[model samples]
Target: MTTIDVKSRFEAKLLRPAKPGNDTSWAFVVLPRDASEQLPRRGRTTVEGTINGHHFQATLEPDGQLSHWLQVSGELLEAAGTAVGGMVTLELAPVKKEPEPDIPPDFQEALAATPEARKVWNTTTTIARVDWIHWITSAKQLKTRAKRIVDACDMLASGKKQVCCFDQSGYYSKAFRAPEAESF
Candidate 1:
């Protein structure tokens, strides 16, 4: 598959916790607006990349301010032997094919228990399913995640085909503030 390769070094930083109970320790590297614009997609772009020599696959997401950024999970940081506030070199290339996201066990069970939801889930497109799974799994607290699962089942059972008010392409959460707003 053809890919667009970009190599750059960036300083990693932890975004402020989305909510009080959330883990703000998640690290990220911001891509310049020009570089982001050259990417294949505007919202979520599937990618295979290297971070400080550790190979990884991830979705590059927009930061809501027309810039793109990659979320550096704790696992990726550990594999790369890096830490928050550290500088890391990244080599990214857009992947033409993206494998399906694995559904969380709890979510899979919830869907199994609600056949109607599962039916609706089956009818949704892959991107829609991805958004739903991302929404449910992105929760930081167990309680929140559980609630999302329940909510998802309820929504799907009610024939809701897509997650409401979610910007799948934007940053980690819908609550993320733009850099300018964050400076205050």
Candidate 2:
């Protein structure tokens, strides 16, 4: 297993959301693997390879952490390495994320109390609610996290769950609407 020891800290920014239609839009600073080399490339062609079994395409940023796209078909096996005169296969390992907790009863009650909130909540998908709930609960502070929950609930009431403004082409487009609300 090849291990990459990065001594320096790096920051990666999302230049553009990765989507279909666009060939490439992401960018990152490219720094040297060795700290001895001071000269750094502001922008470099992203290295395309596999790590831990997942396919990754990342550009080197001025800082150390490589900004790359992680596409996983199966479990990631190993990290990238400098090899020559042989077949080089990227390895990928499983990325484990903490399981989401059940939705709070008070939160559900609040939504149930408000007509608009209920409408929005009814419109939002289970997956979208799960994502929102996970994001809100993940906050470090309870107050701030509660605020996020309120804010998300407001958005749902406003009818913008998983708000998709445009298609892959950056053009405003239509998508299938969520199922109709049930009637008593």
Candidate 3:
């Protein structure tokens, strides 16, 4: 697989595509020279426009092409008497990366809190941590992340690493108690 890295906060000229917003307009997307495939997955990358002050969502595909979707409306096109596919520069600004959460503190705290959690956290490999981080951070809502964290913690305590333990009944415990553990 061929890979081209686009730096975050860099600009590129539209060559093949004649106008901005053209289906082919992405051919000229100027990535923030520092952009990276390693960038944390977020909803959409956006940047301010020099022409209209509109906030446009920009995306960099794996192939190094750029795509932009209109966020405001038809006002800009009408103002310029240009078509939707008219050439325009889509500026891609670097998104502020969030600081990495300290791992040892979280691991230590979970270990101190529950033995099962400690085992799970300890048994988890580096890849698992990366997956969990990406999953949690990608969530747009705080509540969703919190819920996922709770569930992840519960799973950890139950001696399961993600899908390996999620049963059909959604119950983690194998040792079922009579009335308390029964699910109807």
Indicate whether candidate 1 or candidate 2 has the larger lDDT.
1
Candidate scoring better on lDDT of 2 and 3: 3
* lDDT (10s digit) by residue, model 2, range 1-184: 3333233333222122233134332221222234213212211222333432334544322222322122222122123222112133333222122223367775776677667877876666654565565455545687877777677667777877753321211112322111122222
Model 2: what TM-score? Answer: 0.34
- Candidate 1 lDDT over residue span 1-184, tens digit each: 3234554434444333233236545666777676676666656667787777778889876677666777777788888898766677776766766667788899999999999999999998777787898778767799999999999999999999899977665554544323321221
Output candidate 2 Cα RMSD. 18.0
> In the order shown, what is each candidate's alpha-carbon RMSD?
5.6, 18.0, 16.1
Instruction: Tell me the whole-model lDDT of each prediction, alpha carbons only.
Output: 0.72, 0.39, 0.40
Worst lDDT run of 10 residues, candidate 3, spans 175-184
Overall local distance difference test of candidate 3: 0.40
Error of 2 at 164 (Å): 9.3
> Which whole-number lDDT from 0 to 100 does residue 129 have in model 1?
82
**Best-first order by TM-score:** 1, 2, 3
Which parts of model 1 are misplaced by more than 4 Å?
1-27, 40-44, 50-55, 71-91, 169-174, 177-184
Candidate 3, TM-score vs. the true structure? 0.33
Residue by residue across 99-170, what tens digits does model 3's lDDT show?
A: 333454543454577777767876775445544544454446878766666666777788776534322111
Model 3 alpha-carbon drift over 4 Å, by segment: 1-112, 163-184
**TM-score of each candidate structure, all chains considered together:** 0.62, 0.34, 0.33
